[model samples]
Target: MSRLFPFHGGLKTVRHKTESNQQAIRPAPVPRRLVVPLRQHIGAIAKPLVQPGDRVLKGQMIGQAEGYISAAVHAPTSGVVTALDQRPVPHPSGLADWCVTVESDGEERWVERKPVDYHRLHPSELRNLLRNAGVVGLGGAAFPSAVKLNLSGHCDRLETLILNGAECEPWITCDDRLMRERAAGIVAGLHIIAHLLEPREVLIGIEDDKPEAIAAMTAACAGTGYQVRVVPTRYPSGSVKQLVKLLTGRETPVDGLPVDVGVQCFNVATAHTIHRAVDYGEPVISRVVTVTGQVRQPGNVEALLGTPFVELVELCGGYQDGVERLIMGGPMMGFALHGDEVPVTKATNCILAASAEQLTPDRPVMPCIRCGACVDVCPANLLPQQLYWHARAKEFDKAQDYHLFSCIECGCCSYVCPSRIPLVQYYRYAKNEIWAQEKEKQKAELARQRHQARLERLEREKQEREAKLRQKAPPRSEPAVAKPTLETAVARAKTSPAPTLETTAETVNRDG
Candidate 1:
C-alpha cells in the first residue's frame, strides 16, 4: 500500500510561523462593514442579487452563480447593502474588482437551514447541495467543489483519495490548526468525499513538523478505513498536483486533473467545510484565517467572509508601524494587496501583514540568465525560462505550444528566479490574453454563421419571388391573335374614337 503512495518533489522554504501555530485558534471580532468581491473563485464571477439599500441576513445568498463553473456568494453577516461597486481586491496587481459593500447591523443572525442526509442522497443531489452552500476548494484555488465531485460519471476506475493537510507554506497555519482542533470534522468530510468517489483507499497526508495535527488526524482515523500518512515537511507539499503525486505515486498528466490517474485530493479544511455544510445545515459563512506577521498579537482567527483586512489587523493588535506590504495567503503563492481595505473572502486563508523585516522589499527585476533555478524548483516540471522568454516577446502561441496551461502559476519560477522577475504575472497576462482571444474567435464564428444564414434566406426569397412571377405570367399559347400590319393598325386607331390624344395614350399605356 505504501508503494502506491510515494512522495514527490518539493522544496525547503523559510517558515516564519511562530505566531499562529503556537496558540489555539481564536475568532476575530466582526467588523462594522464587509466588502465581498463577486469573484472569489476561479470561475465566472457571480452576479449580484442585491441592490443598494436592500437588507441581507447572515448566510443569505447575495450573489448568484453566473455560469456552470461559478459558485454563489453569501452574505457574511446581517447587513444592509450600502454599495455594490468596485473596490481594491487582494491581488498581485493590486487592482479593483466588482464588490458588495455591506454595513453590518451587529446581528449575526441565521437564516432558515436544513441538513441533507448526504449518505442517503444521490451523488448529483449531494453536489447540488454543495453548490448551493457555496463550497469550494479552501486551499486558495477556490474551484467549486460540486464541479469536482460530479466527475464520477466520467470515470470507471477508483484508485486513491488524498486529503491534503500539509500546510507547508510559511506563515500559513489555518489548515494546520484546523487539522489539530477539528480533526473529526475533517474526517467526517473525508467520509462524505469517500462516499462520492468510493475509491479503493483513502490517504490523509500531513507534514511531520505538525505533530499535533498529525496525532489528531491519526486519532480520528483509527477505526475508519482511512489512512493518515505523515510526510516530510516541505514547501508546496500541500499543492494539489504535488500532493497527488506524493500520495498516489501517479503523476497527473499535463493539463489534466487528478482524476486522470484515478485519484482525487481535497484540502483538509475544504473537507471539514463539506461535512459542516452537508451534515449540519451550515453554509460557508466564515472560515479560519491566520492573521500574523509584524503585528502585536499574531494568531489564528475564525473570521466571517468579507471581513476587512484592516479589521483583522486591528484584532491582531494592529501593525507596529512601517508595515511594508499586506499579503493574502502565504508569501510563496500569496499576492500583495494594495491596501488593507479589501475584505476577506472564501479563498482568503491567511493574511500576512508584514513589515520590512517580515517581507523583503521588491527588488528591481533583471534579465533571466538561464541559471535553471526556476526550472529546478518548478513542481510541474515546465520550462519556465522558455515560457518566460516567449512571454517577454509576446509570443503567446509559442508559450501555449510549450504547455503554458500546465505551469500552474505556483510562483515557484518567480521565487527562484535570479532576476527577481515577476514570472507569474507574465504567465497570468498570457493566460488572460489567450482566453480573451478564444472568446473573440467564438464570437466571430457565431457572427459568421448568422450572416450566412441571413444571406441564404435572402437568396431563397429572391428565387421564390422570380418563380412566382414566372408562374403568374400568361402562357406562350396566348400570344397576340394577329400580327397586324402597320397600315391596318393605323387604320384601326384612326377609326377608333378619332384617335384622341388622351385615349391613344391610355390605350397604349394599358396595352403595354
Candidate 2:
C-alpha cells in the first residue's frame, strides 16, 4: 500500500527463478542412505540416544535435545544406524561435525503418533508440545521456535505475527512451492500461532511475483481472521526488518528484534512444520528443499533431515556439465560446498550445483573507485567501506559499533561492489571474533564468581575462629586489628600484578 522503495541500498541482481519455478514440486525419491546430523537445530548439539547397530523408525527420536534451547532429532526413515561420528556438513569451511549415518529400509515405515487437541491446551502446554516436536524456525536462522515463543515478558501490546513467504533468494523455490501447494496447512498453522500470541492481525507477506501462492493463501483464509498481504517483488524483501517495514512501516531499532516493534515473524515453511507437529504429533524430521543450478533437472524436493547433497543431486538427474561449484541455498546467501558429501540439515533450504556462469564470476582484485554502489544497496543502512576498512584492520570493537552484526551477509554489498571485495567474509570474521571474545568474557565472569565465593568461605572461617576464642576467655579491651581482607592479603603476597591462570597458561603454551 505504501512506497516499497523506502531504503536507499539494494541490488538489482539477476533472478534465476525460471530454472526451478516452472515445474511443480516433485517429491525427491527416498535415498538408500540418509546422513542425519545430530546438531541440525540451533542452540545445543543433540546427543545421540541411539548408537550404531540400532534400528530406528521414521519420525522416532534418535538424538535427544542436549540442553534447554535445543531440539530433538528424529529418524528420517526406517533405517539402521551405520555410523556416528564427525562428517562434513554444509558450512563455509566445509568442516566436519558429529552426524549419524542411517541405512534406509525401502518400506518407509512411520512410528506411532497421536495428535493433541491444541485449542483446549494452555499456552505453556502448547509451547511444550511444540518444543518436544523439535520445531524450529524454518527460515535460514534455524532458531528454536519454543525459545522464541517463550520470550521474557518484554513483549507488550504485541499486535501482528508476519508469515514470511518472500523467498527472496534467487534459486530457492522451496518456500514458494510450499505456499502455493500447501496453503491450507500453512493457514491452519497460522491459527495455532494466533492462539499462542492472540494477535489481532496476522499478515502473510508473499512477493508479488508469486501470484499462485498469494491466490491460494487468500482462498485458504476465506473464513479465518488471517489477512494475506502481497508485497512488492524485491531482493531481501523477506528479511525480518525489511518485511516488517514493508508490511507495518515500523523500523526496528539497532540490536533489537521484531518483538521490539510489537511484531513476530515466522517463515511460511516453518508454519507448515508447526501444522504437522501440532496436528499429527510429528517432529521436524524432514522439509522441502529446492535443488537447482547446474543439475540436470532443477526442481523442489521434500528431503529428509541430514540427507547428503550428492543423493539429492542424483535424484534430480545429476549435473549436466561444467559444475564448477556446489553451493547450499542461493548464490547470494549460500555457502559453497567442497563436495556433495555434506548432509541437508534443518537449516539447509536448497542445494545449488552451480556452474561457472551461474555462480559469481571469478575476477582479479580491483581497487575501489569511490563508486558508493555498496552503500547504495545495503539493507542495514551500514557503510560497507567503513566496515571493510575496520574489519581488514582487525578493529573488531569498532566494527561492532558500526552494527556489523546487523549485516545479514546477503552479498548485496559484495554483489554490487565495483572493487569486488569479499565484504561478507570480513563481517563473518568480525562476528566470529566478537563471539569468541564474548565466550572469554563469560568464562572470566564465572572464574570471578568462583574466586569471590572462595574468599567468602575463608572469611567466614576466620570469623568463626575469632568468635570461638572470645567465648573461651574474657574479651580484650583493645580493638582487634582488622584482619587482612582477601584483597589486602593478595596485595601483600605479590610484588607485581597477579597474572590470571589463563594468561600464564597462554604465555607458557605459546613459548613451549
Candidate 3:
C-alpha cells in the first residue's frame, strides 16, 4: 500500500452529494439557442471563428484558441450562428462577455472526425491536437490541458501524476457521477496522458465519502499499475495543492505550480475528455453538470457547452418554491450567479439552486473575538486573520506580505470565523484591487516607452533634414571676384577719368 500523508487544517463539512449522485448521468437536451462564451478557459479568450448567419456543424471549431495558454471553443450542436455579441456569462462579477449565439438546426449533424494514433504522433503534435480539440480541465479551473501536459521547464522528469476525483465540496457530484459511470473511459484517457508525460507513478485521489467512485475507479485501474487512493473526506481536498500534499506528501511552492514539485494533477473529467478527443476525435463540446438543491429532480446531466442554467434546471424539473439564489459550483467555493439565464462554460461543474434552508443564514456581522478559529482550520496554513485585517484595511501590500495569494480562497477561514465576517470576499476584493493596480502600472509603462520612442524618432528626422539641406546648398564661387568698395572705385576713377570718353570710343571701335 502506498503511504498517504495528512495535511493541516480542513473542515468536515456536510456532503450534500447524494442528492445529485444517486442516479446515472443523463444527456441534456440541446437548447433552441446556445450562447457559448469565448472566454471559457483561464487564459486568453478564444477568437470567434463564426459570425451571424453562418451554418455550423456539431463538433466544429467555433472559437479558435488565441494563445498558448488558451483552448478552442467548439459548436455544441449543428446550428446557425445567430449573433456574435456581448452576452451574460457565468461569472461571479455578473459581467457580459463576447459570446457566439447559435440557433440549433435540430439535425445534430457532426463534422468529419479524424481520430489519430496518439502513440505514433510526436508529443508536440498531440498537444496541439488537444489544444485544437478544446481540451481543458473541467475541475472548475478550466486551465488548458495542453499547457499542463507540457512539462518543459518545470522538471527533468515527472515523479507523480494525480487524477483528482476528490470532488470534496458540498452539493457538487459531477465528478463523482462521472467516475462511477465512465471509469473505463477516464482510465483510457489517463493512459494517453501517461503516454505523453511518462510519470513514474499514477494515483487517483477520491474522497472517502465516495465509495462507489472509489470502487469503480479501482476496478478500472486494475492491471494498469495505476492506484486509486481514497483520501480522507475533507473540505478543499479536491484542491490541487492540498490533494498533492495528501497523495505525495510534497508541498507545492506558493509561487509555483504542482509541476514545480515534480507532480502534475488533472481532473478525472479532463482525462476522460482527452480520451474522447484523441481516441474518438471529439472536441470538448459538453460536460457533466450536477444540478441540485431546490429542484424537483436533483441529478447529473451531460450538458452541452453554452446550455443555459435555466434549461438545465428545467430539465431537472425546474426550481422548487423557495429557491433563493442560483449558484455555480458548490457552496464553499462557488459564487452566486446573477441569474440562471447565464450560459454554462467549461468551468461550470454544478448548478446549485439554493433555498434559504440550503444557504447559510444572513447573520449580522460581529466584531472579531480573536478566538483563532480561522487559523485552526486553514488548509494552506496561512494566517487568515492577518490577511482579513490587511485586506479590510485596503492594505494590499500588507495582505501580500501575509501571503494572501496562498489562501486559495477555499472559505475554511470564513466558515470557522465567529464574527460571521465574509473573509473570502475581502480577500478577493484585495486581490482584484491589486491586479487592477498592476494593470494600470503596465499601461503606464507601455505609454512611457511609446512616448520615448516617438521623441527619438523626431530627433532622428530633424538631424536627417539638416544633413540633406547642407548637401543641397550651392558651393561659393572663388570669393565673388572681390567686389570694389565705394572708396576704391572713386580712387581708381580719379586716376583714369581724363581718357574715359576716348577709351570708351576706342574700345567700341576695337570691338567693331
TM-score of each: 0.87, 0.86, 0.92
lDDT of 1 by residue, 322-362 (tens): 77878898987787888888888888999987778666446
Sorted by TM-score (best first), the order is 3, 1, 2
| Sort order, lDDT high to low | 3, 1, 2
Q: For residues 41-105, write the lDDT of model 3, one tens digit per residue.
A: 99999999998999999999999999789999999999899999999999988999999999999
Q: Which wins on lDDT, candidate 1 or candidate 3?
A: 3
Residue 12 of model 2 has an lDDT of 59
For model 2, the stretches where C-alpha displacement exceeds 4 angstroms are 1-5, 444-512
Window of ten residues with lowest summed lDDT in model 3: 472-481
How far residue 328's Cα lies from its native spot in candidate 2, in Å, is 0.5
Q: After superposition, how far is residue 336 of candidate 1 from its true place, in Å?
A: 1.7
lDDT of 2 by residue, 207-285 (tens): 8788888899999999886788887777888888888887888888887888878888999988998899999888898
Clash pairs, candidate 2, are: 9-376, 9-377, 10-377
What TM-score does candidate 3 get on C-alpha atoms? Answer: 0.92
